[model samples]
Target: MEENQELEQELAMEDVLKNYDFKKIHTGEIIKGSVLKVTNDEVIVNINYFSDGIINKDELSFESDVNPFDVVKEGDEISVKIISTDDGEGNVVLSKKQADEASIWDSVDDAKKEGKTVVVKVKSETKGGLIASYKGLRVFIPGSQAAARRIELNTLVGQELEVKLTECDKVKKNIVASRRVIEEAEIEAKKNELWSGLTVGEKREGKVTRLAKFGAFVDIGGVEGLVHVSDLSWKRVNNPEEVVSVGDTVNVFIQSVDREKNRLSLALKDVATNPWTLVESKMKTGDVVEGKVLKFTTFGAFVEVADGVEGLVHLSEISDENIAKPSEVLEIGQTVKVKVLSIDAANHKMSLSIKDAVEKSKEYLQYTDNEEESTLGDLLKDKLSGVKFE
Candidate 1:
């Protein structure tokens, strides 16, 4: 009878050992279970262990206004972090959201190290950018990292995007994603592929993708080239929009290439007839020309005599009267008549005057028909010699 009792006691001890496994709790272990009951205070989940686990309402969400029903319901399968074993109640305190966050951070770290693209779903909009979900983990995508072009975060809600993991901090539980980096990498790859056989002075068709103050960005077969405002047209341009608009198809000449910087300088005017080529033949010194006022500086006003050809009218020569500034005498886009005093083709400069030409014309009228013609310089020297100094 004593032997039989000893065998029965051994069997009972084996049953107890099977029931209480004494599982080890590590830092980042994912414990899965089913929600047995949920209430405003806490959620009870059964993990088929010795006892059910309890997750407090506050641990259910990172959001402040969290409702238990929104997160879990009865008989719903769930996962939780084994925060700690129960005291005397024989229950385990768990955190569903925390476990998910820990798992996500691990994945994010791996993605960044391997340069892998992660698929994320847009969850909500924040002031700075969008909040996204990746494998049940919340990640932040700043506004500048959202796209290669500006995009509205509101429009991206509920959309899935392939993003590269830029940063991940397990201690702070912060994860940052960047879709722009992936886009830029793709663009650079495409640019390198397209530039392999390209040569200078090559003519290509492109579409204007962006118009900035200084230049327009054109897309030529997935490669972007910059056409500076000065290269857009022979005529002076105040704004890039005056020459090209976003989405406009245009023919451009490759002016230069910097493979190191991945820069391509494009020109629209190079492909067109050069206005300066015919300027020297059509215009000469002492010629009366009509021009439009283009810009004014402190010292002078620049007049557009022809396309890409501008002559400066000094403030002192704008009128016989004294003027403080060129703007006082000339307004932008106003038409004016002036005489070209001199032209230097090599230097690309033209000196213009209105008062000097009028004086010269008056002196010619005063010369007698039978008298020998006197040069203007000779007359001025003779007149100055006769004046007595005090």
Candidate 2:
């Protein structure tokens, strides 16, 4: 009986010592546990410690609508990070998501060093880019770093992508990723494959990707070609949008290709007929042509006399009187009758005059050449004879 009693005392003492030893473990330590009970606000976990640990609903997932039953259930083993000791109510604070995040940071650090690609699912949309989930951790991708080709970040929600870990801060819990590097690498590979057969003056079909003031961007296969606005059409174009818009599939003639600089000069006008080639045969000097007012500057107004044929009506010849601006007398898109005073097909210049035409028509009917010369001399002598210098 005495020996049995001693054995029982030793077993009880061992149990007490085990409980004390469990209590010595601290908060922030990762431990394995089993789900004991689940509630709307918190979940009870049996961590094999002195007391059952309590995991708040917020710690279940970074997602806001997470339900305890969806994440943890009765008798399911999970890993949790201790947040605090028992709150004196026999409840120890623990977190599941935080522990997972800690592990994710470790993996992210390793992946960054190895330059490894990681698969991440976009969790939410942000102003700069998309918020993504990688092993329960929030990762940020800046807008500029999102892709080689621009993408709608909002549409990427719930979409999975392969990204490279570019930056990581375990202290601030900030992780930054880059899809641009991967995208750029792929684009370069595609360009190399396409460039092998591409040469200057080659023809290619491409989609217009972007329109700018100076030019339009064309996606020729995976490479980009620049078709300057001047090269868009044989006719004058004020804006690239007037000739082509985004997503326009167009056939472009490659004018020049610089492989070293990765530059391509494209021309949409080259594929079309040049209007200037027939200008001398179709148009003549002294012809009264109706033209549209294209643009006005301080020097003159450019008028489209014919298709791809433009003439400048100098500010001096626009009206009999000196006008401050052409806009005052002429408006955009207005048709006007102009006499072609001179046409230089070589230089692409046509001198146009509105007042000279009227004057010439009046002189042709009323004045003789001898009579006009005598009268012009008499008027000049009368106007200048009285002017004397001291």
Candidate 3:
């Protein structure tokens, strides 16, 4: 009976040892635990080990100064890394901050691979930029990368902004981000969407944003279409700003669209009521029209008889005498009378003749020696009879 009782006691001791081995936790191992107690400077965690774990205020978080009770309460389950199996005392030393930092770094790596944007809180300032804390990872945002336009860096203080990670280096513990990158990406997407719906001959309304020497840029929605100086008006447009000023809303016609290059050819001229259409009805051939010479070319001089209506007088028709150049007969802004010779409204062309305007009619007086046959002697005798041979 004594031998049997000894074996039973040994077996009971072996079962207890096996259970302890199954629940044993090693140092440097990360595990989850429930908070058993919270104090101002330390939190007691139960890791299912024989001894409970203690996380001091310094190990609670990455913050320089922190209170354990402020973050963790009793019965809160938190993951912690066991720093020491036994620190001379019976309690284990655990670090919740280290575990959190490791987890956040993994997320940052994933974000970098996925090309994702992250929201970070501005925590403090750095030398050349502001430091933001994402989860627990610190990201650096340069002053110039904070906005689409340059602004005061301190303006971002305490403001939460979304940013893309431009550089993420886990080995060097460096993370660089840009707020401008995210904004530009969003704008590009909207611009592409705006371009997709556009087609040739699409009528749209827009606001003039600015004028250039070559063209003007208008904001239709998200895209900016270029209105060249030539397209601003049917008449001559020496300057774009003269026709449309900045911030003016105007109706525009899309002449063509190049989707591959994101280019739109636009027009501001009349589509149905062209200024040239009224030229034939208002003036007829052979009618003398008063006009101002606007410009001179090698072939002729362009004269404006009415608003937006111009007629060309060929070099041969400028004068009855030969001329080497149109400038010899007409200067810019000089007023002259021109006889309309031909009109081609479909092609927006009009021909005029200045020499025809000053020509003599067919009944002009002439001088010749073809009088009647009454001789000078007969006339003399008649005068002698009337005057008594004076």
lDDT of each: 0.84, 0.86, 0.84
Error of 2 at 215 (Å): 13
Q: Pick the candidate with the highest TM-score.
A: 3
Number of the predicted model whose lDDT against the real structure is largest:
2
Candidate 2 has what TM-score?
A: 0.52
lDDT of 3 by residue, 31-147 (tens): 899999998878999887777899989999877788776788899999999898888998889999988877888889988889898999887777888999887778999988988
Tens digit of per-residue lDDT, candidate 2, span 1-390:
999999999999898777555655697899888999999989999887768899999998877878888987899999899998777797889999888777778889999999999999988888888899887788998888888877888877888989998888888888899889998998888889987878776688999999889999999998898999888987898899888989999999988888899898999887447777777898788887789999899988999988878999999988898799899899999998888988888777888986776677667656687688999999999999879878
Cα lDDT for residue 351, candidate 3? 96
Residue 115 of model 2 has an lDDT of 94
Tell me each candidate's TM-score.
0.48, 0.52, 0.77
- Summed over model 3, clashes come to 0
Q: What are the RMSDs of all candidates, in order?
A: 13.7, 14.3, 8.5
Return the clash pairs for model 2, or none.
none
Per-residue lDDT value at 325 in model 1: 86
Candidate 2: residue 235 Cα off by (Å): 17
Q: How many residue pairs clash (N, CA or C atoms closer than 3 angstroms) in each of the candidate models, in the order given? A: 0, 0, 0
